[model samples]
Target chain A: MKLGRHAFGDDEALMMAIVNRTPDSFFDKGATWAEDAAFARVAEVVAQGAEIVDIGGIKAAPGVEISAAEEKARVVDFVARVRDSYPGLVISVDTWRAEVGAAVCAAGADVLNDAWGGADPELVDVAAEYDAAIICTHTGGVTPRTRPYRIDYDDVVAAAIADTVAYASRALSAGVARESIVIDPAHDFGKNTFHSLEITRRLDEMVATGWPVLVSLSNKDFVGETLGREVGDRLLGTLAATSVCALAGARIYRVHQVPETRQTVDMVWSIAGRRPPLRAIRGLQ
Target chain B: MKALVPGTLALLPSYASIEDPVAPLRAACLDAVGRLGPRVRIVSSAATGGSGARVGAALVAAGGGTVVESGETGVLVVGNGSATRTEKAPGHLDERAAAFDEALRASFAGVDLELAEELWADAACLRDLPPLADAEVLYDDAPYGVQYWVAVWA
Candidate 1:
């Protein structure tokens, strides 16, 4: 399952755990971002089968400052602490800032997971400069409180791929190669729950884009809305969403509860990959 | 009043430059369960094969989940992709319908398909047009017949 600069074996769907150092992140508030919390959580989630640890500072929930320099400084300490603490781990720095990306790269971060489809075009340079793998996720406007679930595109999957391709083209123009990048359909970023469901439903189609797929639907608000529950209560919904992601050919899953999501991904992957390759298609349906 | 069949869910319609009927399937499934009960699950199951029998055979080889019918709240949403051709008979669908139908299952999302949502919950699920009989025959060609993965339940 190795995608770009990162590596995830096919033993199961890759389990990338969330280690939010920020106080306002939707889940795991101040739990793992603290220096002490980092040490404990790294061991816990890694031991629980998290091959990748995504550490981030600040919360991108709605209405937060979307400033670049602020994002960089917040995670500088995060990257330094995690990279130093987990010498052998694959650390993914989650941000949409080139400066933050450059800083994390300076601190030994192995990958960059951008919520925007390389939201910062300059991120391509940072990724290339740092020799790190970059996962270009789908991005749309944020309404922190609500996740819209409707059809902006008659086919969300196609739009996702086209947007990703355009982003990839931009990254390529910026000197990032195909092997250095990955793509996500921007699930829940600009979508409501139903739209998120549609993204999940049509994921395999996105994989057809050929970039490795990194799915980060861990306990997101869409799951919260779909299950008619809150973040903590949406574990089952999260598991189901992960299962669907795995089955839909997502190579990576960004989740808060690594152990459980990893187990679920393994089960679904074990069942899905043994057969023929996933049928590939185009456009949105 | 449209149905999305399975192979259609594979982005075939997208490849063919068609609109996937997933939203319509969502609409149809909601309508079916709303008009009936709320236990039915809408699963956009995807599979590949040439005909219903062929795809159904592969689905069996690949393994099948539940048999969907119009009982209380059991029906498979004919799957994804854009509208291709139009036909007006039961089982008059393109090749993808059978393949999608074979692989459909329940959503583990914990969604009570039998229930409705506050938003976009008023969508309808029509098995066939006035001229078409079975959902299978009319896989494509409806005014809003975007394909989806087949939906199934107990």
Candidate 2:
């Protein structure tokens, strides 16, 4: 798959580490809200072997409304600093606004991770203009930043496939490179616990759509509600969901913990016969 | 010409690892096998299509040679010493394994079949061959708690 200037093999599973620039993001809770702290977080994830860093200025949940100018202020310069320092890493900006998308792309972002599914129709055009990759997610027609009050689907996996595939085709029609387009079943975005769980169980259908599948199951509310755990305690549940997706052939993982998720994916990849053991001579010898 | 190599399953390509655990042994085995001429005959107690015979065939093919039943240019012997050299060995440490292997290393003739079987050694087909002192010993070590030797006689 091509993420702007970077091209990766089809068999490789990538870890996209989360670098929050928001002061009220759910998981980090303003830990990396300061620009310097966010830069340090980028350095840490890079040292831990992450291939991509997803920088998000606005929190996903409903909170203080951030304008496009304010969102650009939070992420544009920071994206430039990260771009200048780490040329080999893929920079993905998580926003649904075309204005923020264009600004971050000018500052050297490689991917636009539209977590709210295509709320802005012009975001794909901006991706095409900058020659950047776009992540097309399934949000069940929910508006940007709105919670799923009583969302129901005839079949959650089918709905995810239909919506994400339509978005991917729209991106392709807008002149985005076919290889640069990816589909994601956005966990907990327009999904409750049951919807998210069904999506996880049937992720292979999304994988079978022939566009590379990306899963954002990184300590989300679905995991917390499933295991009766708080946000900080949802890592194990997240990893369990990650294993299911990995076995179903999810290509990219947007995660908060780089090393732990990488280990989980590598282990599951080997189990699925997509990877070989590092050095195996136990019974053969 | 003739060559001898341990019939460890690790030598097969199907059992290979990314970082080969038997790299040194594999190199020595390939070097010895390459000198055994074009058409070779494999001698092993393993079933005709078994893993040991497969390793022998792979080595012959890798050396740009073929295995034939008749009119062979050289003989390739597939067998190994005791597998009970240490506590973690497949046979789990037989007290008499070391002495039996030491004696067999000096000469392949007059092997005690009963003791060889007890020690989990594949020595039945190792009989009537020239002693190790008469060949070029490319490798002689017991890695992975299993004794292995790569030797060539010209």
Candidate 3:
């Protein structure tokens, strides 16, 4: 798969570390809200062997409304700084606004991770304009930043597959390179715990669609709710969910912890026979 | 021409890891096997289709040679020393393993088959080969608690 200037083999599973620039983001909770703190996060994730750094301005939860200009202000310069320092890392700006997407792309972002599932229709056009990869997500047609209330689906996996595929087709029609488009089942974006759980269980169906699948299961509400744990204590639960998605052949993982997720994915990848052991001489020798 | 390579299954491609644990030994074995003619006969005590025989076939194929039952130009012997050289060895530590291997290093004849079997040494097919003193000893070590040697007599 190609992410702007970077190309990877089909069998590779990538770790996209989450770097929040929002003061009120759910997980970090303003820990990296300052520009320098956010920059430090980029460096940390790069050092931890992350293939991509996904920077986000506004919190996914509904709170203070951030303007497109504010979003651009939060991430565009930060994206340029990360790009200049780490030329090999894939920079992904998590935004659904076409304006924010275009600005970050100009600042050398390789991917536009629209966590809201194409709330802004022109996001894909901006991605095509910059020749950047776009993440098409399934959100059950809910409005951006709103939690799912009484959201019902006959088959959550089927709905996710259909919606994400259609969005991917839309991105393709907008001149985005076929290999540069990725589909995601945006866990907990417009999904409750059950919907997210079902999506994780049937992720192979989405993988079978031939588009590389990206999973954003990083300490989300679904895992916390499933395990009856708070956000800060949900890492083990998140990793368990990550293993399920990885075994189903998810190509990209948007994660909060890079090293743990990388180990989990690599172990699952080897178990699935997509990768060989590092130095296996136990009994063969 | 004659070559000797250990019957470790790690030499087979199917048992390979991303970072090879038997790289030096594999290189030595392949280099020795390549000096043999296009068709070579394999002499091994391992049962047919066993890991030892498979490793021998793979090395021969990798060296641009084929295994043949008749009309062979050279012979390839698959055997190894004791597998109980250390506490972590497959058969665990054996007090007599090092002395037995040292004796075989001096010459291949007069091997005690019962003692070799007790120590988990695959030396049954090694009895007829010339001593290491008369051949080019490419490798001789026990890296993973299992003694192995790669030698060629031309």
Candidate 4:
């Protein structure tokens, strides 16, 4: 997949490495929380096989609370540094605020990965204003960590599918091209494991919606339960899960272990093959 | 599929209490993976934590994983559909119940180990795990374990 027509193309699956610059983030602890370390990791991921890098200032993750201004600052510092580190790299800022989105785009972010399904209209405005490619997420039936209510859904796949389509429609209306828009069926965002497994098992169906997809299933508990391993020992599980995502039709993968996941994608692509099917049905009769 | 270190599996009673390791660990484990990057897969730390050396020893005994206390979130923040939920028990039962029962019942040869508790939602509150301060557990009978899904075709 080539982002923004700069001749930047991923030969196989494009791995989007995460560079979160936040204090309360569950992962990273203190490792790569620093600007220099974040910058270095970005380079390493690219060198390892990441086609793109996603840097977020504030943790947009569930149960996290951040004011817009603070979000902007968090994104600005690391994104700015990373942007400077690699002029040719495809950098993205994971923010839903239009202001922060705009600031990051101006600061050198190439894409906007919004987890809010564009619920923040300003985010769409920012994408349009900045002329940056956007990744519109559909967090169907997600259970917000901070909110006081519990989330319940009867048809998770259907709901998520609808959410993405609806959100994409909004993005299209906002001037995001069909090709430039990518959809993510937010796993763990709200759905339970049953729903998550159902979605994953039926991944091809999710891909059929006529848009590129961004999958973030790294080191997550889903893979952990499968292997009965601990959170710290999820490397191989992360790789396998990423492989499944790639095999299922994910164009972009947001990951923690960049090099290894990239390599895994390459290996699977060779074995699984991403060849477009023969078009006998469309051939001149 | 090795679990992501510090990754959360399901919201178990062990980690469920507002003040317990289950709730907080869920957040912390997610962060660990977020920090560890995508290569590390996560498992349910609700049972993995609070067990202290037992959890670490189990992980070490299982031979190829690390263990830690999960915080308030998960790396994937999945819908619990992607994971394997166990019967509701405090963060103490996951692996213990299985082997505990397995050892006692394997001798019977025909008997299957009974699950300690049915997995549940926040609303179930079957066990005596503390509640999340002002928070409610929502669907009490929600099965344990949920997965954070990847992108798929529509």
Better of 3 and 4 by DockQ: 3
In model 4, the runs with Cα more than 4 Å from the true position are: A5-11, A60-64, A141-150, A275-285, B1-154
* Tens-digit lDDT track of model 1 for B105-153: 2222232223211111111232221222232232233332333333322
lDDT of 2 by residue, A214-242 (tens): 99999999898988999899899999999
Candidate 3 - chain A - TM: 0.99
- Is candidate 3 or 4 superior in TM-score? 3
What value does DockQ give for candidate 3?
0.86
lDDT of 1 by residue, A51-120 (tens): 7888777576664664667667667776787777777788888877788888888988888888766556
| Candidate 1, residue B65: how far the Cα is off, in Å | 42
| TM-scores (chain A) of the candidates | 0.86, 0.99, 0.99, 0.87
Considering just chain B, what TM-score does every model have?
Answer: 0.24, 0.95, 0.96, 0.20
TM-score of each: 0.58, 0.95, 0.98, 0.59
Off by over 4 Å in 2: B47-49
> For residues B1-154, what per-residue lDDT tens digits would candidate 4 score against the true structure?
1122222222222222223324433443333333433232222324323332333233232343343345322221111211223433333225443443333222222222133223211111112212223222222121233211111111
lDDT of 3 by residue, B24-75 (tens): 9999999999988999999898632456777889999998889999899889
Cα displacement (angstroms), candidate 1, residue A30, comes to 2.8
Report per-candidate DockQ: 0.08, 0.78, 0.86, 0.01
Q: Cα RMSD (Å) per model?
A: 20.0, 1.9, 1.1, 24.6
Better of 1 and 2 by lDDT: 2
Worst 10 residues of 1 chain A by lDDT: A276-285
When summed lDDT is taken over every stretch of 10 residues in candidate 4 chain A, the lowest stretch is: A276-285
Better of 3 and 4 by lDDT: 3
For model 4, state the Cα shift of residue B30 in Å.
56
